[model samples]
Target: MAGLLQRVKSKMAIFAHRKARGMLDGEYGSVFRGRSLDFDDLRAYVPGDEVRDIDWKASARHGSPLIKRYVAVRRQTVLLVTDTGRNMAAEARSGEVKKDIAVLALGVLGYLAHRHGDLVGLVCGDSAATRSLPAKGGEAHLERLLKHVDSHANLEAAASRIQDQLHHVARNVKGRHLLFVVADEIAADAATGQLLRRLRAQHEILWLTVRDAELAPSRQAGTDPIARGDSFSVADSTFLAWQPATSAAVQAAYTKATAERDAARKAMLRGAGITEGEVAGSADVITGLFALLERHRRAG
Candidate 1:
């Protein structure tokens, strides 16, 4: 099989064509505002680069926008947090496996962190256990992190409780770092909200929610492919299928409930001052991350 980081780079190459080249790097770098006065060098400014970093005199002399690079006192650490559980083996909104989407999302961000000269680490597991890897540089280390997430997440894994991983990070990891979380559509609750707030206090966080598949199909979408086949729940033995003959009232109720639940999840993350993004499939991971990083930079 092709390496995961290589797939990430391939997606980036496609994204680079759509947007300006190196725009992802510029956007990713702009999020962390802390920088030392020790000047390293100057380079051409990309579209997403912060305006404050533009050297006016240098730009005038060089005849284009230029951004100043600084020699950092310490390298930043990016913690890739995710869930490895049966839930991830289920279908996504795009009719693809949630675990595949999660890997793409994680790989994209981790690759960006690697390109930024930052150390990348991973914290992923199910409710039964959580695991952590030390932060380190290099593409080989990043590939190992991605492979771990890809290999461990399956239908046979334990149930997902993303809070466990967050708690592990809160208790064991020290120092401020960038925590990038990719997980399923988690329900909102008081305990999880409290834990998120606590984690937010110690680290800058970015959340990517892998969109889950719809449980029921609406009457109008009766001819959809998903509606033709049966669906099984990973959380339990209960099986559900998209019924074309389902009542409009039931569809409306499900729509309303889903909207409310999503609102609550967004509010919970917002309350903790963390930026959140959503990806329905692997195809949109790059665009979704670009939007996520842009929003994070704006929030900061």
Candidate 2:
């Protein structure tokens, strides 16, 4: 147990290091720079154009008109709501868990938001709304938020009532802010859609569903029974077991169900005029977030 805990901690540290470096390097585009006010390029300074923007040297060299281009100014607030519910504890085929993946995703986003000088805030919800960290600026604020998230065992309880939490968040946050939700694919439902619509009316929302490879269809079959050692309780001294054939069938059904849920979730997001995506534990969350951020910047 101690060894596994250490490994998890080490993995988290490494992920954080890589993520922090990526944000610092600004490899994911310059959206974090907030829109620029100064002209970046100068085409031909058209007639009636602002004379102040004329590039005299370029005009002399080209023997034609030239104008200075300035950067646009765009600033936004980002809010991250992470569902630390019981379902997020499922273990992926590679031994990675959904809750761990959620933390990594949240950490990366927090780091990126802080680096970009955006106000960063977190709303963690489970069976009920647990913690609400109002959007704030500074690395210190992000650190505090991350620490609060890391200290809690979100999966210790039963499935989370995300819809209720969303309603609560909507009531408290009443502005145009970027909202990112991280959760397992299984928990998204009809209520989630309703809440999404209400929230989208006031904010830019993005949904990221984390999944495990074992949950996929291709790897759902095998001869051995799916079993794991008893850790939650000592009442049973033997490993829990289920026939591979049965397990495979069950997994297939789950996969189908999850797919349907994902489709529904996507449609709801689309209806809300929001963008969404899924990230597997085996995949790179950093890359996923970078793509989302770029898309959001372009849309802006």
For all candidates in order, the CA lDDT equals: 0.87, 0.64
Model 1, C-alpha of 3: deviation from truth (Å)? 1.0
- Quickly count the clashes in candidate 1: 0
The digit string of per-residue lDDT tens for model 1 on 1-300 reads 779989878877775574653677788888786632348899999999989999999999999999999876557899999999889999999999999889888888888888878899999999999999999999999999999999999988999989999999999999888999999999999999999999999888999999988756444444544465656778884656556427687778888988999999999999999999998988888888889999998988
TM per prediction: 0.82, 0.66
Off by over 4 Å in 1: 15-18, 35-71, 216-228
Worst 10 residues of 1 by lDDT: 217-226
How close to the true structure is residue 39 of candidate 2, measured as C-alpha lDDT?
57
Candidate 1's displacement at residue 211, Å, is 0.7
Flag regions of model 2 displaced more than 4 Å: 1-75, 186-189, 212-241, 244-251, 297-300
**Candidate 2, residue 18: lDDT:** 68
Error of 1 at 129 (Å): 0.6
Q: In angstroms, how far off is 193's CA in candidate 1?
A: 1.1
